[model samples]
Target chain A: MSKVVKIFHGPQHPGITGNMSVELDLIGETIVKARTHVGYLHRAFEKLVERRTAMQAFTIVCRICVPEPDPNEENFARAIEEITGLEVPERAKWIRVLVLELSRLAAYHLWMGGQAGSTGLYTVPQWSVGYRDYILDLFEELTGGRVYHMYIIPGGVRRDLPDGFLDRVSDVMDLIESKLPEFDRLFFDNAVFKKRAIGTAVIDPETAIERGVVGPPLRACGIASDVRRDDPYEIYDKLDFDVITEKGGDVYARALVRRREMEQSIKIIRQIIKYIPDGPYRTKIPYPMNWKLKAGETYVKTESARGEFGYYMVTDGSEYIRRMNVRGPAYVHGVSLLEDMLEGAQLADVAMIMNSLGTCPPEIER
Target chain B: MCTDNPGVWEYIANWARKHSIWVLAYGTGCGAIEMPPTMTSRYDAERFGLRGAATPRQADLLIISGYLATKTLKRVIRTYEQMYDPKYVLALGSCTINGGMYWDSYNTIKKLDLYIPVDVYVAGCMPRPEAIIEGIIALQKRIEEGRAEGAKKYRENIEWYKKNQREVFGDEMLPDYTWNFEGGI
Candidate 1:
């Protein structure tokens, strides 16, 4: 047997999904053993939320997942909405769905860039990341910030949609929809991606279930699992979309599930733009600092682009949340699932697997 | 001294460095999400000669994209030390300025410059792609003006930096060889 060469994949690597590292003990480029190292990006989100008021906590929760912040905001809002018996307005519900789907689309675009960039296909990142901007423009118009939309707050959304915002959303949807075929030509159907991504890092359905795999990775295993369909939040139950799934349970399958879901996101947004009712965007929320939630415990999950994102909250009838624990999908997939998958895999496939699993470090550590 | 008065060779080197910046984007926090749009197609930072460098050794610019967790700060220092001289550090997001939204988070460090020299700071919770490109332009201008002397500042004040790093990291501080500038790894 060849002697093992130990290596760290990131906290600083371009190939790494985020600010997390994997320790790989390899022999001839095949990983013999893999261990994950986190806390490189830990901001101790769980601890910080316990001290802040409900309104103050809302602003920070989105920071938990950089690629998809809305899911966190949605889950946080929904958790309180459930715990306190708060009611979101009808218009706010539709707008929240629009925001969630838009963020999901933006995340998938970002994921495509990561997945494609990992295989050294440079053009796909350029195309996809650029297209993601159109959605961001819509977000900026609606929420006034591009990356972190702090719009989906406690009772409802922060404000009403801008005039003609739906029209703009539709236009962006049209543009992104029009470009999907070109992406298909360039990436999904590309021979190079298929050869490299297929059969590399296959997650069998049993293993996927055993590991508590969620989101696209779970669906990619042919299990058809999704939080939106299973436990619908916001207007997700009302919206029509499939839990896009694929067999083979490899990097390509995960990529396909996300790619197909982009259309469903566009479709959902189109429906939202068509069916949304006009009224007060948000119900009256209590004072920002002095609001106390009812003493209760609740768990809420949303289908983030990565998979199921959840927040478990306990309020002791105080202005501050008694406890808020995040169940970010990466917590499962990034650590244990990832280490298991990396064993015997080529050194190169490390990045590919991480992207396929949608392992965001912030979520794992938060 | 080079920060104030650049020799003829220094001017030429700075000119090259200003034009062709190889960025090793250390995605330490949430601000990393904006980097793709900045580097890839939408903003296309390459038009300004800004591109992603795979490793620290090959990089001229280091972007601390958001709040530096104490653990990440150690790695950032190691990364900064591994990079050759004349390198610039561009700090993105308000987190690096004053811990941004993560100020209360125990693990996160408030100011980036306390641990390493920062040449430019682009402030926002997460600065937009345009803002990041503008920050890159600012760094480029600083390089051309011979004002972006972060690496030199780091070398000169390594003691203070190490002290601050040690304070936060306690016994978990990085190995000395990583920051031993005169020893020359």
Candidate 2:
């Protein structure tokens, strides 16, 4: 007779992303049940926002998702714009798109690094992390900070683009595009990676939608439901680009979707570089401390690398936000979906499954 | 006749000591982004015998990169306790020292050394790769001179460390929802 064995894969396990624990019931290496444990990195971000003014919350929003923080800023700004009926300058819209696409590129690069590392492919982390730094260099040149770029604010961005900014961005894009083939050689096309990744952690299209998987993970299931396309915001409606999708919905499929999406992000960046209008990048708002927003609420959503990152903001005609709730994709995918998907998989596939789903704990905790 | 087996075992032991220095990548905040590049080929921290180990039991160095919130401080303490003796702590970034930009913020801890003993402090919002390499070398020098033993002494004074941590964090250690805001550092 076989007996059930309980195993705790931690807030520190390599199989788990960020600081989160998952309790698994296993018979040998095959898992029978999975339960997610949060509160490990819970920082009370929502309550903290409630205490700060709307403008002050701008700085805190970026901490919601460290790898892809721009969407939080974008959502916060857009919600405020919607509440006050503030008109953002056309040029500012283009700049917002540029920041978002760059963020997407950076996030995809990070995901590629983590995904490769999960499978014992060490060289990919080396190649992708080095390539990711070029993007960080561009961010430093554009926004003064590398990781927490508090650049995207309400009304518009914090400052205007510096001289030859577009030219420098284009140069970085060219370098990133040039290195894609080498990444292909190292991880994407390598036979060992293919053997381990393909058909592991399979997610059917029906299961994906039911479980609320979003971003590349959803796209990998062959559903082309990008908020940038379907619920068009910024200049995404005006831009022309294909929504890359795959049918497999496995770890390999998620990797393929992100890989194809990187090229699309490059294409989007090229479009922004070619067509950015000549005008001011920001529209000044009233003094942030004394700013009184109209009494209303708005739900703003953006296509972050993880998925449909949305923020619902409510104001009571006061400086302090009445309620600000974040709907990070990780809450649903990492907690609910991951718990269901891990059951019956081999122990070795746990990390691959978590990576494919893009389980960021900070986002979930927030 | 007296020089036949002249300390060959000692030579091999010294060589092994010089070649392997496993690091526990105890990332506490945003500065973790810089860690990948250092560990990767751009700087190749591995050439200096710095490889990221999953468990603290096998590691020789603990790199506390970026900020440590009151929430993260508890885990860092637990991880430090779990690590074997003769371990060194390298606090990376300004946030880990005096809290940097987050100094005025409520959630982040002002000083990491107040909770656990830190050997070398690498100063920068996020220190550049060159600075990190320099920090590793500085730590190696300290190790050669037996500076890491100080950390072991601090650990031996376990009650003192716990009292200081409680004094800093207060009722935040409890799992109550109200304690989240009231007892924040």
Best by lDDT: 1
Task: Highest TM-score: give the candidate number.
Answer: 1
**Predictions: Cα RMSD each:** 1.6, 6.0
| Runs off by more than 4 Å, candidate 2 | B1-20, B69-72, B93-95, B98-110, B123-131, B166-185
Q: What stretches of model 1 exceed 4 Å from their correct place? A: B1-5, B181-185
DockQ of 1: 0.83
Per-residue CA lDDT of model 1 for A1-366, tens digit only, reads 799898988878889998999999999989999999998878888888887888888888888888989989999999999988989999999988989989989999998998999998999999999999998999999999998899998889988887888888888899999999999999999999999988988999998898899988889889988888887777778878887889999988888998899888888888888899888888887777788799999988888888888889999998889989999999999999999999989998898889888888888887
Candidate 1's TM-score: 0.97
Compared with the true structure, model 2 gives a TM-score of 0.89
What is the lDDT of every predicted structure here? 0.87, 0.82
Candidate 2 per-residue C-alpha lDDT over A202-303 given as tens digits, one digit per residue, 9 for 90 to 100: 889998898888898899999998999999999998998999899898889889988988999999999999988988888989899889888999899999
